[model samples]
Target: MTYTALNKQVQSPLTEQDKRIIATIIQRHADEIKTLWIDCGITVWVQLQDGGRLAFDRNWFAQRVAEEKTSLEAQENLHRQNQRLEAELKQACTEYGLQHGEIDYLMFSTKVYRGRDLVGFVGFHRFSQMWTYSRRATEPDRYARSASDALAKLGVRQLTMV
Candidate 1:
């Protein structure tokens, strides 16, 4: 709706594309988006074509991010557990010589969401490398050689998620 003053100062002028994205975010996530933006200390504000200004807080955005991180961890844990159980079941089927169906390796996309709104998604394959590099960066001793080797082999592509 209506905002009198931007909670934080925005240096860049909002573009039409930004407006569209914000409108989509607001429409899709509603209160969660507002809360997350406010929590994260990020600004989403625009001077409209009609000359009215809209503003939102960054801290609110962070809340959504935090929630999403929690959700992702939970989902990943559940998925790993399910995979383990499936493997056990498959082993049993093999022992009995039963016709076991194909075991599909479920690859999920790591979605970047602002609350319920999906801003982007990184596929499982992409995320795996991301995890590897990030792990190497943080824990240098464990992956130093492998990380450097990967970087040598893949160059910048090793760091890119897209």
Candidate 2:
């Protein structure tokens, strides 16, 4: 089956406090790689309606640094490997494999709430790498079979796919 993302259950621009919190979250994530995927550079925390902004600050213009500095040949090889893996996935699940126009940025959507009211939105984050693959989300559905019961303990209703 295909995935459909959720629109906001509430509407309004983020309050100053919300902005500050988001900023702090970004600053905190930069140095301390918490959760690897959820709070890292690749994990973009975009709001739902009309699209949104990053929860973390991405250095819009940063020269290649230490670990990230790679030669062109290595980059090309990685690109080819990713392409091969993507083709394999498409062949495995043809129906959901083709994303017409969507960027299909790897992500997961979680309800945002403040004082029991839905407010902050959870966004799609990377599982690993900065890969821009869509079908990757199917992995979460597989996890849901076990995660749902545990999430229910945290008061979550269900694990929705995107």
Candidate 3:
């Protein structure tokens, strides 16, 4: 089965306080090495290179960072894995023919590599009320999965033909 993302259950723009909090979250993530993918409502998805998804509560993120800091080796390995995962994530997006606008929300999927060779991945998908619809959202099943399906078939075709 394939993944289908969710749209907003309500229509609402972010409040001033919400913007501030969002900005802080963005800024904090921006300073780090993590990459962030943002899905605004069900209408727009933007991949931010400077920051990872900011959908988490501030304290939770802080706690994670603190825990990570306790082990220097782990932190280094994690950073390496993040770098590899960033590339693989981009590749998956391309291979699957997914546009940045198609994502419903942010997912922090980590990729691991060994000596420039990618190994595996893990992901954190955030489902929260952070974005408003910039435009009316189309039905989630309508368009998003088509590209992924087509791409998969295309891959099989190429492999078989080769």
Candidate 4:
């Protein structure tokens, strides 16, 4: 039967035989059935010829839509946060007279200095997701404040000085 005829029949009150015929046709053209239920003011359930049933609740549909919207919003928020972090990093690099490439290349061997005195070695630690500093060959507590200040100026929040 043509889709127009099937649509007209579905719009009208259906008898048991009519329902069976519609179910059979739907099973044969499952991909073409974009909308399963019409405005009959009643929940509709149809068993296909293969014994699989097509059914859904309006409440379930609404819940799924809400979930998708929440997921999209969370993704957008994460993207914005990443962008803000990147901008902050760029600004910090410029203010500290440091280049991202230099930091990356000399992360492990580079020494951070305050004026003419060497405070510590600056490097990025992958496991801790932080920039770390190892104090020079001296007391562990020495240059702690200077190391903290230097890392802060570079926008490195996750910093550890030892």
Question: Best candidate, TM-score-wise?
Answer: 4
lDDT per model vs. reference:
0.38, 0.34, 0.36, 0.46
The best candidate by lDDT is 4
| Residue 94 of model 2, lDDT score | 34
* C-alpha TM-scores of all predictions: 0.32, 0.21, 0.23, 0.36
Give each prediction's root-mean-square deviation over alpha carbons.
18.1, 23.2, 22.6, 14.4
Model 1 off-target regions past 4 Å?
1-55, 99-162
How do the residues 113-132 of candidate 2 rate in per-residue lDDT, one tens digit apiece?
Answer: 32354322222223543222
Error of 4 at 44 (Å): 10
- Taking all chains together, the TM-score of candidate 4 against the true structure is 0.36
- Steric overlap count per candidate: 20, 2, 1, 0
So what's the TM-score on candidate 2?
0.21
Per-residue lDDT of 1-162 in model 4, one digit per residue for the tens? 996687657754545544433434444453323334433544444444455556546555445546655766776775665455345445544545444322333223255444465545555443354544555434232122233354564344442334
Range of the 10 consecutive residues with the lowest summed lDDT in candidate 2: 141-150
Candidate 3 lDDT by residue in tens digits, 54-154: 35444554555455446645657667655554454456445533323222113433332333543323232223311111111231211112222323422
lDDT of 1: 0.38
lDDT per residue (tens digit) for residues 1-162 in model 1: 224344334244444444334545445422122211232346744344344545666556446546655766777886885465445434433332222233334642222222344322222232333212121213332121322232232222223323
